[model samples]
Target: MRYMAAIVLAAALLSGCQGADKAGVNGSSPSSQPEVSPTAMSATPSAPASSSMEEPLLYIEQLRIIGGGQLVQVKSNIDIDQKSLEQALKNSLQTSDPETEFRYTLEWESPRFVQIRLHLDENSVWSGTFNLDEAVTVDGRKYASTEQPYRNTVVIRAGDGEGSLLFQGVTSGTRRVVPAWNTGWIKPVQTRESVAPSYLFYGQEKHHLVHALTGEALEIPVFAQEKDAYGNDYGYHEMYSDRFYEDFTYMISGNKTLYRVDLKGFTSKKLHVFNKPVYGMSSSPDSKRIAVLTAHDEFIGPGADLTVLDQQGKILHSRENAAFISHSDGFLFVYSLAWEDDSHLILPADRDEHNPLGQIRYNTGNGASSVMQDERITDPLKQDLKEHERQPHNDLLLSGLKWSPDNRFAAFKSGTGAIQVYDTQERTFTFVSAGTLLGWMPDGTLAWADIKDLVYTF
Candidate 1:
């Protein structure tokens, strides 16, 4: 699955252009000129962005702050070539016109590692690992990462004490304005052997298949556990999508009896069990109601298929077939819920008529609903733009979509570990997080996780 994701990512990065377009980065005014050529140019899509400024950025590599500096770490299956680094370091080094000092920047030459910020110095020739956070140690005294340049030298040169000295660039005091991740996942006492390992909630739980280094793959249920119960604890339950509520999401649980969590119920009383024990669990868009698959029909007569209960664990509106449910009543197989409009609820489910397995919006009012997102269901939608949904994908077969914090779109991982996002309203798609299994918030915003052994956030 990881390999598949890597391939998909590679193809996506090098696909040229789908139909006919210019080869530009999100069409940022052609580098050169469009020219008098008749053929249209293909362009690279711009990097993904969210409306919220606080969203944590998702990087293909790890990001961190260490050595009192903002440094980036790189990893590679191949061996690190010190000779190559020396050559690169030699080329990266540069001095001012006056030739008072040297300034060479050495960007780490690895691919699989992460990015973190570390030390700074006079002239602060920002290292490849320098950015956002940079520490300064004048006279051998370690100081904060924020330090100014002096002596016309733009770098510290990582004296003999330093293991490796890379080239450098200009130093900066401005730190990146990224959201702070949750820290609860690690706070709890956990061990390496803990089951139901805690998780991070960058956005919310989403289903893109997961793969291990051993080449084993499975559509595992994974997500960031929780961070201060953000978004009314929805991050622990839902995913994002373009169509307000129509999206794919779900929870992995053996206990199918419990439906809605009552606010008044507190910890113990908060647990609300459904009258009908079934396979799926869903929540209402309003966060006021809950819906569960009633057992009355599956094996018996005209089954009272769905049960609707209020936040207080009281029955509100019980319908025969809750094919149409409100935010108060989430959908089956969907760990999350969204709102298409005041009258409709967007849920991720498998519909026969629209066999294409994208997100389907059900009109709870008059049962008059349309397809909110069919494109995600690669195979099911058959790529029929004429139809309300999109044809599902093949290599990447993942489900259980979730909305992000900003409530803009939905995201999920495919069987191959490729992560995709579907606009709720525009019905278009934009790639967000991509890996063996895109866990945490589907939107890719950073959140914290408590996996028993460690509590980390991204």
Candidate 2:
């Protein structure tokens, strides 16, 4: 019932973190954390070089934050009372006490990176930089180690007049994203065997993939366009079989029927005949599993179902009303359900009294479903919304949720006309232009197409 409120809170919180240019380091206790912007980092000057008799209430170990291709700040969270860290202007490195231990955490400030570390001794904290030297300084405190460098840098260019550009590589660390060639309005593609690859675009009648260099039009007749109420034609979803591309599959949800078609054999199967339209679909990486979702439009609060099938077209599992919520709009947003792997499928679940905007990860092999919670959005906001209108409002904007071929990133189109990419490994997010994410290319670069069928890679 509070799904909408949870989403509103999530958006505001995510935005706040994005706009802030600093990393925050504070005591383990919430009350001890400072409200200072994490970005204000500088080298601290050396202090008097003698240990003071004053006892430290806290023992801070270390803290660091990096952003925009450079280390933004580094502070050794060590109190000056116990040990006189002042060894100014000289860059001498000495190992600290072998028994000393610290805690570390890496946070991606959306488009940037931030890492914070702190040393703690039981309940006490030694907060601030230690061992002043010449290499770097934080808040005027000198340190022996140099700041960490940026991990990556990327550049995106809108295509020339023809709406096309080449895909060379992405700018990261020392490497840069450069184009290899140019062409007319088209969608460039990265294939299994090639990097300087071809283009896939919608022609006057159908879709085609043309070789960028040779100008050869590779015919792909499987993509058929269907017209909507306004007479605008649009193509449906199609994906190739994993691994060798030996087969491909697609879906066509008609008025009362859902068609699962195998492009390799040019065969169509009526997977389901439902009174309500089929709303969502996704396939597993191994091409052996498929999950389909459907919902009803009615006076009932809101409800949806999920059905999984195997390679032999047999129903493996089905859950009715797995997602149910109450809102004035009575909207049940089955945004997207995806297979994390052959055995795991992740779906959005309604936020209840216990779980915040939570997601359900179902293990097909074990029939176990667990919730993967994100604290950023789950935490309640200061403002409250009317209970009846609390249905998830942003679900439609994120209906196109998809995972990259490599499973390292989950790419979804944000309402802001950009793609929000979630790095599974780093547990961080980055933004890209609004394009149809074609998954990872042969060379490990991300590829997508804009409204005009212009392909870009990063």
Candidate 3:
């Protein structure tokens, strides 16, 4: 079934006499300027402008389109001819099927602008804008200007499918293209009281830690500056806890050593070192215990072990080959570790033919393992996976499924690079923009990096 797509165009009217006199076009005086036919202006009510003036300067102010369960709003200030505005709207609002019929209504938003609402029965819509100031007439067709600034700038490009906006630093030359859906302005919601302290590993060599909330940085004196076989530099790869300390955060270095860094003093203290490389780490909700996963090598395979350590790095429980299982492909890798509570560690097991994607519950108190049956945790994980599969494209990476400290929301990077937060209780997804998930602040706010800056959203 096709949904009705609604398009609303807002146009601002200026003094026609002044605009025409300034242009001095066709050797016509303001008094001799051609009048817009009543038929051309019949659909729209008379705009609130100077009735004494012979003409009114018209420019598209904003365009809002709603259809196919999506809404796109574009803001611009491009001049357009009144006689051709109706036909231009129709041409730009056309769907894939050329025969589709549509209608529009005009509403006066203010004395300066009028809103044109176009309604169509279609599944998708594509629209673009043109700067009519520099347009040229060719065979009765108006071609947009090819001038430098106007030609390079895209006033509006809206569609039902995925789109992105490229952002670049004015002088730094740093560039990032985020999903266009995230470009819409939204009022920040006050949903949390205190945010978890978040940090990001950023620098030319990624050997520096910057606080996500504050613009503070600390150089890791002992950070592993080595490179992998693939020429990828190794440093701090993940931030384990943002809720553990007020002035410190727990992070794992590339060399398999964990450290607690002071966010205020800008110092680092070695916490513990794993014998093998660390794949994943999770701190208990109480911040008293830490679960570390280590494997024989960096790549996923056999010989994966799980260790429960105290805050001082003393081992409380150890299990060999407990995190993964062997399969035809060599091993079913287990990662994305989190704690269901202070006593139970939850591991999302990799899917295999014999077993669907499931979770393993490791009891820290008894050192026993079993299939996770807690509906509270399993249900949310299952729902999150189901939503991930429903995304249009599946090839994109969907990683970093971290649960909120309260276990109410699960945040992950969707296929389109947008950080989607899934509410376990509400069973809904919130697009938090395109970036790397940098864990959550204690107050339920999410922290992420958009390659250019650290973004915090709730």
Candidate 4:
């Protein structure tokens, strides 16, 4: 229930960090966040670093937040003793400890490169360059580019000792994201042949080898890969059809589910096979249950059958052909799970023959179904969405939804790029335009990604 509230705090707490130049939010918590104008923010710098004396906390580690083509800002320890590292961050994050003179190392990720940051204390702004040595070797060559000089000059402010490392890049920039700890982050994609879309990163949190792109399916860490309650490996452990692509188009049921996987060393038992072909599906938030749509059929339109199951693959309940016999709104059937709630499922219905408009929603735990939005308006936004790209969501797929860890919110963008919150609980709308953005901050404030020049929109 407090899912939305948590993000609000995160956004506000970090808004004063370097990249939040357009934000004017300031508050200790979300409920009291105050609004500031663009003009007001332009007049000041991020809040001067704080001076807490306790051991610095790490807010971000491992993963870097990539936006457009560059790293925005590293989110790290939001609360830190600002006085500890004043001189060490002059060049990089690694520095000799002021008191013990011991080694301190840190790493960073970007859209195009990987870097290491070293700091000795909390206060020092970066020195003129990235390192003290005159030159560094690359590929056994003492290469130096005058145009792209090595910059060790790093800066830090209050509570940023544990910040997430951010890098510089543009969305279309030619630079590529290189991996640092080869074993920790990236791994050889098991597909054998790599081209066009080549490479896989161990999604530590999701427990899969997720493709960086929007469309491909990543391998789920199952059985044999499960090393422990924690420390599991995510790689090709068993024999799965290399020729088949996981086009998981439906969210019928389960916290997480796959019809089948072949893991090695670890044994598994088959619970239930589909009575028919599997189609769309959704799973509960707890990951204990599952719901799936049956195989596709070419009627006047596409129709589906719904199936429910448990983690052990045991059939709980089955519903066949539960969807309408229309495909005009093909996008509505994009997924069967609500974004916000794991306890619900979305079923698509034809708005009309052309499939331009469709109805979609989920069956909540209350034994009641909720319509995402009535079929009273047009789908409005349209573009060439490749089968894999899912963001810049369609309203039908997101409306009347719920979140598990409260990671995402149900918001809508109109033709003009204005986004409004469709609060599922209040059933009311709060609009944010180019003028204002309302998202959750680490400290529970209304935070948002403020865009300047509109080079692209989806």
Candidate 5:
């Protein structure tokens, strides 16, 4: 699943574009352009002339921000006199030099408001935010324009000492805003582990961990045993729980053992190991219990086993399944299991006439199990699982299902590409949007990547 996510992320970054168009990084002239969203356009579709016109007149009207703070769309009044508005625009428009100019293109045709695209290009085009609301009269108001140079050198350091970094280009203005770790990064608590390094297939390099936000290097303690089977040193691949940086458990697969380590005391405890090679694991919310799903070929066996163990390596529960044992099959069967709470594990069970993907709620408190169904069956709409939803790959989609930190809501991508949030209390499935699941914000807000792969928060 991690590898799959890496591939998707790579493709998204390569194709990510700003605003409505995948225009060139340096702003292009507004002659021929792609159509913008209706919300971003004015009522008229024909673009006003840019070359011969003395001034580009734009009627100001209702203005609203969209795409977080990245877009501003406005409706221009259609009844205004074109010549008078053009003259007013001429007075307001200014350029620094021949290489830089303010360009405009008209968009949309509707009963009310005309849409326009405005760009200011120096080396790159910039869009600005405006709060103008009043109708234009001849007394022109002077607005100050600032030009910022693109700086090639921008250094960012970890302030809280840990987090993830997203590289971004300047969206607006000349201020060459290179994304830095100091802003828009999530800082987790620092650990003894050095940030993991990017790996190359055939090399003997010392790997380091990078902060999730700051991109700073971090070094994690992988117990006293740090070398692999061939006595080669390698970095660890960690699996963190929902608690994330605040409090969680992590396990390193190298050295054929699982060791639980703390960032504060640097204490190490060996959890478990299959006599043969083991592949993947998932930790419970409280970090007291861990489910280790082993590889199928690790031993000559007809069925694979899912082993639940305490932090001290005490076996609590184990079950057999023909499907659970193999990672080579491209799916982790254990992904179907979601922790309903610290004391309850929700595992998929057999479906019946009423419940489609039946669930078995296993009580970790007493090693008991019970059947659980989607309470929505009582609704008058009465929806059942569709054919495509029952596919084996659909179980993998469950891996995207993220319950809110408080367990109030569960967000997952439906087979149809729409993200749905299941309200545990209300017993209802509400359509959030058509997007890929990212994760929930610390404040419990849901975030996702839309059809275009742009991240959005709700």
Candidate 6:
């Protein structure tokens, strides 16, 4: 059971010096300030000062800025050797606009890990943690140190902010070099209501009809009373097979019984029932037919049967072991079992040597199955793999491919934990915040949920 509530949009503003001491800035000045070195800072952690020196040098490890339609990872090395750490940071970090200034707060989690909250303004703030012990590389340039005596490497985690920052780094045999900002990476767009759409979602208490454009949600009492094998009112539960039939009507399954519900009047009628448990359901584009995927037995294991039914609950076609069930993280569910048209259904087939996980196009008219050859589905998967290879870490495989209602956009989880949306029309990709890709709204806006908030985006 998934628990969710209304979205909470809060701007986190961290203030004051809470963990600045952990950064090795103890307000006590060095016995003697060494002459500023003209040599470029080394990418590795600075060597520890000798017993004659009073303080160790500080270095900027990793700095990332997310805003202004761009995600920037600064590929430069900065060394600070001033008497005051506060004055050194203030002089080093600056925004694009000279008129606007910024403030920051640091909270030390461990000796080397510190959480930084940078506030550019009341509306724009970013908070992320930096681990000084790890080394991260963007493109070909690297920042921070691999191990201790702990270099002053600052890696800012992704946070909510708007605007850009400009900072200079040191290069060998030079006075000071301001490296060019790498803007080649994908930019994260702001969440806007203009591109959002209306949709329905199952909440912790009941069903919610959400209007994304206006940010309004209406509660709809539609949860069926679930019962155990002994026939007691176990609790209220929403099944995975529950889906919308057009905009106002919904088809949901409880136990082995199916119900057709009208949202406007809150009325429900019996549709159909299967001998076993219902695994998944999808309504046709025309809403004239429904395709249901059911488990073969109560155990609900690997294989499932497919049943196509008309709006009148009459079975148009039925096949045993027509769809294959895949398990992930201990959850048993069928893959995409959607209707390509009123007469054809696209469903997963059993695994084979040639096609380990494949799908087939099942024709309801002739009861024939054929290999699915739609490039609209296959091309984006190939693109995800290609995109994954370009990432710094390629071990994280892409999963959870979800297409929009109009089939204009496809979304999936990328290797970096961010949700990457592929625009099939433009043949481009955009990165969004990390979350689970919920179903798309009627107007094609994508909905997703992180641990705390439910975000709607396009």
How high a TM-score does candidate 6 get? 0.53
Colliding pairs, model 6:
40-171, 61-153, 61-154
RMSD of each: 21.1, 17.9, 17.4, 21.5, 16.1, 13.8
Q: Residue by residue across 317-385, what tens digits does model 2's lDDT show?
A: 888766544544433222446677778887766665454444688887777888765432311210111
- Using TM-score as the yardstick, the better of models 5 and 6 is 6
- Candidate 1 lDDT over 1-458, as tens digits, reads 00101112323332332232222111122232111111111122244432332222112222122222222222222233433333433443332111233332224323211222223343332222111111211122221121221111112122212111111111111211111223221111111222112222222333222111111212223333332321222123322111111122222232332322121221222334444424334555445555554434333222235554655667755555544222333222222334444455654434345533344576655655566544544443334221312223332233355445554555554222223455555666542222212232322342211111122211
**Model 4 agreement with the true structure over 299-366: per-residue lDDT tens digits:** 21267766667767777665545566444522222223322355666676655434333545545454
Count: clashes, candidate 3: 4
After superposing candidate 1 on the true structure, give the runs of residues whose Cα lies further than 4 Å from its correct spot: 1-265, 270-275, 294-304, 319-342, 351-357, 373-415, 418-458
> Compared with the true structure, what per-residue lDDT tens digits does model 5 show for residues 69-109?
11222333233332343344444332212243445544433
Off by over 4 Å in 3: 1-201, 204-243, 296-303, 325-334, 352-358, 373-449, 452-458
Off by over 4 Å in 6: 1-20, 24-197, 212-218, 229-236, 240-248, 328-335, 349-358, 374-411, 421-430, 438-458
Name the better of 3 and 4 by lDDT: 3
State every prediction's TM-score relative to the real structure: 0.31, 0.40, 0.42, 0.30, 0.40, 0.53
At residue 6, give the lDDT of candidate 2: 15
- Determine which window of 10 residues in candidate 5 has minimal summed lDDT: 149-158
- Cα lDDT of all candidates, in order? 0.30, 0.39, 0.44, 0.31, 0.38, 0.44
TM-score of 5: 0.40
| Model 1, CA-based lDDT | 0.30
Off by over 4 Å in 5: 1-236, 241-248, 265-267, 276-287, 295-304, 322-343, 348-355, 364-367, 377-436, 439-444, 449-458
lDDT of 3 at 241: 47
- Candidate 3 is scored at a TM of 0.42
